[model samples]
Target: MAGAGPVVFAAAGVATLAAALLPRVLSRAPISMPMVFLAAGALTFTVVEPLPDPNPVTHSSIVLRLTELCVIISLMGAGLALNRPVGWRRWSTTWRLLGITMPLSMLAVALLGWTVLGFGAAGAVLLAAALAPTDPVLATEVQVAEPVEDPEDDSDDEARFALTSEAGLNDGLAFPFTYLAIALATTPGDWLPHWLAVDVVWRLAAGLLVGLGAGWLLRKLFFNAPSKTFRLAHHAEGFVALAATFLAYGVAELAHGYGFVAVFVCACTIRAGERTSGYHRVLHQYVEQVERLLTVLIIFLLGGAVATGLFAGVQWREVVVALLVLLVVRPFAGLIGLARGRTGPRERVVVSFFGVRGVGSVFYVAYALEAGHFLEAGAVWRVVGLAVVGSIVLHGITATPVMRFLDRKREVLTSP
Candidate 1:
């Protein structure tokens, strides 16, 4: 007990180093950095007898905040990584994923949770809402890597952009459904009107307004300020990415809106302006670093949670539910969503298959469990834990190879 603090600090130092180094080494390999740290966390916790249990149910509050932070920061990074300006036709893939794939996935997952997994109505909806978004954190392999400094060089690949933009928007868009679950749980009989008025309409509007407003203001300060001292772009400090992230998130929350949406919209808004500036790259890189560090902690704890029997009381059917979500529901839903879209068949398949789940899943589950009274909280946690860990292992292994194959095939098709 006396020496645990130093051990934690030392372990953190090692994790930080791994965070910095592992991405490059694992980039082309089938393995991912999240996979390595996740397994490491499980192994370390399982072998060591003195470590504190990292159960989500046991420490819901800490898990809630940590996962929340990871999601918001990662949202900023994902948003900043986009190169294309937003337009209906340009972002048709994103709209398809968010408007169609996400809701369809949620509906299917909810049905599975209720019928196959034996969850109640509220529990089923919570499960669906928890898993509504493809996690921006763990799906980095399938996402855009960084902002392009050159304006003319568009790094916009359909599959990658769809996944990244979908993850960015859906994490926030999924909130209203999450609140729907909470409303159903707490105020079942008369919840519809209140849900529509507050959760769906007002909150969504507030987030969009706050995000746009904050993004524009920050853009002015960062790029077009009259005074040199006010221009943050000149400094290139990089930490301002965090400042922008927090500012957008905080303002949106203060407006009683979805902070996740605000953070992402703010990043995209800032990015839309001055597309050629090197500042976007600096901001993206800094956000990526911070996101990676936070991810190490969350995924590590997740692996520890697994080793400590996060699925101890889980049923075989619940495991089946988790598997179905990844293998069947998401893939089919994504395919159906992308039907008639601009993506080629192969790109559609790639986008549909890599709906990776990670920190965002953890955050929603924790948030709902903490806010609403659920009898199946433990069971739900086990199923969600299964889903998230399953995703990390499954997607982590397939991401590099599949993306490389797609890249190779694209080059072949376009060659003269």
Candidate 2:
């Protein structure tokens, strides 16, 4: 334990370098950056006894804030990279997933948690709500890679767009359910009306409205400022993305709104500012770097938590429920939602299956546990951890090869 600080600092430097370069290196590989870092963190934390524990329950505050930051930054990145304009018809896939798949998925998971795992009402609902969002942080492989400036190049294809947009939009949608879980846990009776009014209505509306106003103003300042010097986009200050992200989120939170919704909406509004501007790309790149760094650290700590027996309390029923979540509930729900929709059969399968879960799940659980008393806190953590790990490993191995195959099929179909 003597002088462990220097070694930790050195390891931090190496992790930072890997974070920058891993995406390109692993683009075509079956393994993903998350897999590598996750395994590395587990191995390192297990072997190095001097390092601090990474347990979520022991350090709930750190986990909550860190995961929240990662999710919101990722939302901003996803929104900015999307080339598709906002429209009801254009975003039908996202809407379908949000409207149909998410609720169904939540209902199914909550039922399983209650009946199979004996999680009780509040715990079951909390677990379901926590796992509802397809994590924007761990879904980089299936999301938009960069801002699409050219109309001819539709890098944000149907499958990618569906996943990306759903991931961007659903995190905010999941918050109301999380609040429902909190209300159920804390209140003995008469919470429904207030929950419907405040958590469901006011928070959601405030987030969207705040995001719209902030995005509009920021877009003006960035791209349409009267003076050349006032136009930050002309300078290509990548840090402005962070400024906008934090500003939108903070303002929304201050207004008693959902910050996750505000950040993503703000990003979308900024993207709609000047479709052809190269500044969108600059901002997206910076946001991606920041998101990547935060994701790496959080995933690494998660791996450490795994090594430290986060799953020691996991039972057979919990295992079964977690498996069903990834293999059955999400896929079936997504498929049903995507039925007779925009994508073809193959795209539908990919979109349906890639319900990747990561830090956002952890954030929700931490937030809920902090806000309300859950008797099954340990069980919730165990099951969520199991599901998240399963998602990382399963999706990590398949994302590259499957997406490559999808791309090849699209190429064949489009070839003249």
Candidate 3:
């Protein structure tokens, strides 16, 4: 297929079509669209010759942009899907996951990297930060569905809600530590003060403010603009999700802030603006389609990368660490975070165990590699690739059965 552009286009078109249909086709089964595409990619590259190498390092810029866009789009869909109002008591589970569980997971993974995988401080920290946040894109099966017609139908079951909300916000929240990893890698010494002043404080605050401001402005334009012609929501153009995503992200990044945080926050702010409007469904549907397309492309490339030796030189220690991050680190941290909080034992376990890692981890690694010197870059890629692949397979296989079981249990428990 060398120089056969139409063949390439046809293949991609087929993949996109499959992406649109596979979720429903595979629903309630112990399988996922990502699994299919990942396997397809591996198999295709394994059998096909003269295919372009999908090494992320060789295509860092493309990798960064692909993963970044996937994340931003997913964050928008996540924000639109959530029905819950932000509140201290109402979002207690979310607060617990963000405040307690995320840090704990990061520390544990970092420790494993340092102690077991023999990574240096910077490498360990980067891996910890990258893998800490549950991916919003790949976790969609466990997240809330589209915006309902009724306002009271807002929140999902606690398990879904907690996972959804945690995945939405944590991607941005993990940026601080990712920057710290960069700081340690790049600087000679004494970057803490700079990190505190800029990375920790200013970037986060700016992202929040910019997100709120952009979202509020968009709300006015969409819902309450004086001119009916300018009231975008009334028109019900779904592509506005892209406009909003780009606007919020661009504005925040221009101010030296975390665009990922701003994008997710802006989505939440938009959800709050018209909580009951059907317009949200329009916006969400559009964003979800785009997000799915991006996901297919990404996971396909990831699979191709693996088939072409992305995981070469991967050692037993690194594989063990990857398993630990999935099995021990996240589950334990999640349980500890949700301790004495809302969810029951089963819900807690489901929420904790379904922290599926995917595109976001790749984003963080690429971003870090761009920002600083990571001596063990190959090791980082291997471990991260294994961890992500493991997550897609392990979580993808079980998410359906686990969720189905929980849904039934919830019904039995909640029946009047």
Candidate 4:
């Protein structure tokens, strides 16, 4: 047998090549490229005797950084992909999802965790908060693609596009809930006043303010600077996306705000700065490539993690909870939220169905575990892991076929 190092290297090379080529090969198939890679990782680890364990619990920092990078990169991509201007009316669907569906889902899941799963209040809140946001990293298929040539066609079907954009932004929005979970874990029940003052008011305000400020500063630097050398837009540098991500995130965290929100907000602000500039396209292109590469790495590692017994303690109850989250919780929450909104039935169903959980959930879980102890940490991990895996497989398989069907349906409806 080959050394583990050589085997891992070879496996990665094959995976990368397969990721690049799989979409082309499976263009007509219902299977997703992610489903294939995840399966590959699980099978490889299962069959290979020399592979080392990649458990996230023992390797928290690495997992944290990896998912963190994956998310911010996806944020950049999501921001650059959006052609719609940021406004309440323009983004009505986004607002509805953020305001209504998100809270409902959080409340429902928290209650389930508390009453049904018998988790502590903190653990229940943490689990609900962690799972509240749709993952920005893994829902790429249903999201807006790189700068659409047609301005009119830019927004994905009302449901898909709105859900995609909502996911993009709300991944950060859920940070406050995670903080609430932490507070509940650390403080007494009467800590609600402080939590309201600090966690609810200060953190949310700071994240938005800091993100807008950083984005404004960056926009000026990138596009309005006096010095030619200082004009980042002129240089078409892509790595600055990472700098922006870290800067916004670091600044927000330093000020005790939700860094995730700040990062996404900053991206959106920067994007709003020069919506029509070719420079926007340049930045987006670079970010999308980086996001793709990072996603490949995270998913592959996730596969390795699964093979290393991430799901060892998974019980039938955990499986049931995971299924309910995907099938029952999110879909119902989304549908109810969008009931009177702009989306049609097909669009509503698509949006509700494709609430794919990915890196954001991983980050939230890891962050929560690090910040607060949970007796059922193993059980939480098992349930969340199963949910993520189920999403990757189920959503991945359905995304393409469903989108194609919707497209055809739209064409037929519009035909003379």
Overall lDDT per candidate, in order of appearance: 0.91, 0.93, 0.92, 0.83
TM-score of each candidate structure, all chains considered together? 0.98, 0.98, 0.98, 0.93
lDDT of 1 by residue, 1-416 (tens): 57789888989999999899999988899999988988999999999879998999989999999989989999999999999888999999999998889989999999998988788889999999988889999999999988987888776789999999999999999899889888888988999998899899988899988889989999999999999888899888799989988999998899899999899999999998888899998998898888899999988988898998898977899989999999999999999999999999999999999999878988998999889998889988988889898999899999999999999998898799
lDDT against true structure, model 1: 0.91
In model 4, the Cα lDDT at residue 348 comes to 87
Candidate 4 clashing pairs? none
- Give candidate 1 regions above 4 Å deviation: none
Give Cα distance to truth, residue 60, candidate 3, Å. Answer: 1.3
Against the true structure, what is every candidate's RMSD?
A: 1.1, 1.2, 1.1, 2.2
Candidate order by lDDT, highest to lowest? 2, 3, 1, 4
Question: Model 4, 349: alpha-carbon shift in Å?
Answer: 1.1
| Candidate 4 lDDT score at position 276 | 62
Q: Candidate 3 lDDT, tens digit per residue, 86-186?
A: 89998999999999999999999999889998889999999999999999999988889877767677448999999888998999999999999999898
Of the two candidates 2 and 3, the one with more favorable lDDT, higher being better, is 2
Clashes of each: 0, 0, 0, 0
The collision pairs in model 2 are none
